[model samples]
Target: MKLIIQIPALNEQETIAEVIEALPRKVPGFTSIEVLVIDDGSTDDTVDIARRAGADHILRMGCNMGLARAFSAGMEEALALGADVIVNTDADHQYCADDIPALVRPIRDGEAKIVVGARPIRDNESFSPTKKLLQWFGSWVVRKCSGTDIPDAPSGFRAYSRDAAARMCVVNTYTYTIETLIQAGRKRIPMTWVPVRVNRVERPSRLFRGMGEYIRRSVATILRVFVMYAPLRFFASLAALCALPGIVGIVRFLGFYLSGDGSGHIQSLVLSSGLMAMAMVLMAVGILGDMIAANRSLLEDIRARDLLGATTRRRHDATILKLADAS
Candidate 1:
């Protein structure tokens, strides 16, 4: 099987070559092993350095689009290249490159379609105490939402089978790590995580300005994915929460009316009516959202099928051409 390893780099001129050099040159795979570098609008010598470091493919972006978009682009190129599997790692070389075989072993064994390299968050010396706690909390929340016991939800190191790679669609521009897990879980894609080692911090993360910003963006991504995946359930539960209390208050106001002195309870009636109206709106929104989600799913399926067919045709054509040349 042809396995392509993708590194998403941005202004990493200093360390891009080191990251590329550390990559394993051989694995127990069927055939070729290639390196694909995604240059995310680097103004520096990152592209040139990567090229000199023996990168098989360098997909360059005109401007910085963020990690999620770069990842999506890399996956598209890998698919078009007829890769049997794809592995993603950071350009900072934070992850241990030696563990790549272990990372992809499960995929080779048919145990999972997607494999996440879990980090020892708490034990990492580079993480501050607060960062450690935040990491734990974030991973816990992701575990609950994803129904997968991934200890490192934000790790950039991961492997995807060709089928899983084709089905992946990163809508969030913030990051793909958490969003991909949530999508795979919601879609019932088989996933597994393996423990992996991480190197010391070479540079601060450029993805966020600070921990506060990261938390804000991460929470927004989680909520957005949840709504997109299960809009009806999410909004219906919210609607019930508002409407149930309003119904109770309205019933109490009716009792007050029958008792002769309902004038004092006018405020309660107004509040109840407002709440019921809000609940109705939420329910309507939920219904509309469900319809939109269905349409999005249909479109996603169509796109996946089209890409898969194209990849297959390209592979067949390449084989026939090779055979003709040989003859």
Candidate 2:
């Protein structure tokens, strides 16, 4: 099987070469392995360093297209080249290349369509408190959205089969690890996680900058995933959050009115009514979104079926051609 290793790099001039060089040259079940470096408009010499490190293919973006777009482009290219499986790793050298085999083994064994490298956070490793909280919250949100128990849903190091790669529709450019998992879960693709040790990188992480940014990005990712995969749950949760306060207010107003206290009845009634109205509106929107998600899923299913049929036909044709040549 053809296996392609894709690394998405953005201004990783200092450590890109080492990361590429560290990849294993050979592995079981893979007849050939190709290393692809996606340069996301790095101003530094990232492209040159990757070329020197013996990359089989280099995809250069004209400007900084962000991680999601770069990754999508790389996966598309690999799929077009007939890669049976693709592995994604960061160019910052945070993930160990030695763990690639472990990451891909489950997929090769037919146990999973996607496998994620879960990073171990050691006691000695220090991260900001806010960053830690965001990570925890993000994992929880992903679990809720995907209905899958993911220990480390935001891990960037992952392996995907051709089916999973082709089926994913990533909207977020900054972060897509969690979103991809949610999408896979929605598509009924089997996924597994393998624990891997995280190595310290030479460059600072973009995710470790500040608490506010981390929280904002994490929330955005969660919401995006919710919309993409489980719009019903997303909208229902919002409606419930909005309507809960109104429900309580209405109950309190009724209690007061029944208790012969009519002084603040008008104000309470107005507030409760307004809250109920907003909740209803949100619920309607959520229902509409759920319908849209259903339609989208049906379309995706048809597309996937057509693609698989085409692939099977091509393989059969190739076999026939080989037999004719032999005769």
Candidate 3:
């Protein structure tokens, strides 16, 4: 088995070396362990330092893509390079390197396809009160969208089995953490979480500026997930919302007409008709979106199978080459 730890970096020349050096060369379940550094077009010397710190692979994007793109790129590279299990951690060393074994244990034991590290957010002294509350709320929204009971969703530190990693498709450009979890849950991938340690972040987050922005962005991800995975449900809810007011207006108009004041209720009838038309349009949209979602599911299944097969063949060929060399 091969385990590859991937760290996605931006302008993190300060901590990339420490992050790469701290990774363990040997884990309990894997014979080979390697470090992969993904430099997201850093202006600094992140690539050179990561190489000096014993990084086995370095992938540099042509331009400064966001974290989400960087992560997706590294994941694909690791899978192609025959990583049986992949661990994703921060470039700033926010997650403890010693805990990598625990992170991969769930996947190794066949317990979960995806395993996320649950940080002690409430007890962390680095978080302000408002930030803590926002974390809780953002996680709550993610839980609803993902339908998974994992305690933490915003934490980027996670481990994925080959199958799970291969199946992931991240459409969100701002962040991958929340969207990936939602994708896993909607796709019915087994998921679990274990408690992990974290170092206090010395610098402010580059992801977002304020807690309010966090909530807003998280909700946006939820909406996107809902639209992508559960489009019928989302649009149906909207149709129902429109139907309510339309129904009320129609009932009011009927009551007035039956009471001999029908002339004055013309405006009410017109409004009800407009609302009902809107409701019908929304319902039609929901049906069309559901059809598209079904097709998307089928396509994703085919893609996943093809990718997994390619990865498996690569691993097998690599093993044979090693044996031939040894002989």
Candidate 4:
């Protein structure tokens, strides 16, 4: 199998070389391996460093286009080069290269379409406490939503078969990792995880800088993933949460009135009425959002089907033409 190892980097000149050097030179199943470094508009000598490290291909962006776009570009290139599998790794030398073979093995064996390198955060003290907390919460949320137990839903180090990679259309730039896992689950792609060792990086993470920001972004990503895949569940949960207080208030108020205790509870009445109204409004909005999500999902399915059919037709036509020429 032809494999492409993609390293998306921005201003990682200091650690990129070490990261490249750490990658294993040979794997058992891969017939050809190419290293592709995507320089996402770094003012530093990241491109030069990547070239010096013997990267087979380099994609340079004119300006910092963000991680998601850089990864998309790199995946497109890998696909164009007819890569059967693509492995994504960080440029900060945090991930262990020795674990790459294990990560790709499941895909090669046709057991999984995606394999994630689950880094044990306990080994590194460099990760902020808040970041760790957010990761835990995010993983829990993903597990609950996707019905899949993932140890590291936000890990950037992962391998995807060409089929899985082709299906991804990432919309979020910063939180693409979370979206990727969620989308893969939605696509019914078999996913497996392998434990990978991680070390302290030379440069700190650019994404999770502060505790509050990290938490906020992670929560937002979780909500976004829920909306993307299961909009009905997301909205239904929101509606239920909003209706709980109102339902409780009404039950208590009615019980008191029926027992001839109190009918002049204006506060309770107002609170219940307001809450019920809010709940109804939320439910209405949820219904609309669910409809939109359904339409979007249908469109995406149709597009994927069309693409697959076109590819199959072209392959058949080419084969027939080759047979005619041979005859």
**Which of the two, 3 or 4, has more lDDT?**
3
- List residue ranges in candidate 4 displaced over 4 A: 128-134, 251-263, 302-327
lDDT of 1 at 199: 92
Candidate 3 lDDT tens digits, 70-150: 999999899988899999999988999999999999999999989999999989888899988878877887788889998
**Candidate 2 on 30-101: residue-level lDDT in tens?**
999999999888899999988988999999889988888999888877776668899999988888899888
Model 1 misses residue 288 by how many Å?
1.0
Clashing pairs in 2: none
How far out, in Å, is residue 107 in model 3?
0.9
Q: Can you give the lDDT of residue 225 in candidate 3?
A: 79
Clash total of candidate 2: 0
Instruction: Give me the runs in candidate 2 sitting further than 4 Å from their true place.
Output: 124-134, 241-264, 302-327
**Top of the candidates by TM-score:** 1
| Better candidate number, 2 or 4, judged by lDDT | 4
Estimate the lDDT of model 2.
0.82
TM-score of each: 0.98, 0.86, 0.96, 0.85
Which residues of candidate 3, in runs, are more than 4 Å off? Answer: 323-327
All candidates: CA RMSD in angstroms? 1.0, 3.0, 1.4, 3.3
lDDT winner, 1 or 2: 1
What are the Cα lDDT values of the candidates?
0.93, 0.82, 0.90, 0.83
Error of 1 at 13 (Å): 1.0
The better-scoring model by TM-score among 2 and 4 is 2
Best by lDDT: 1
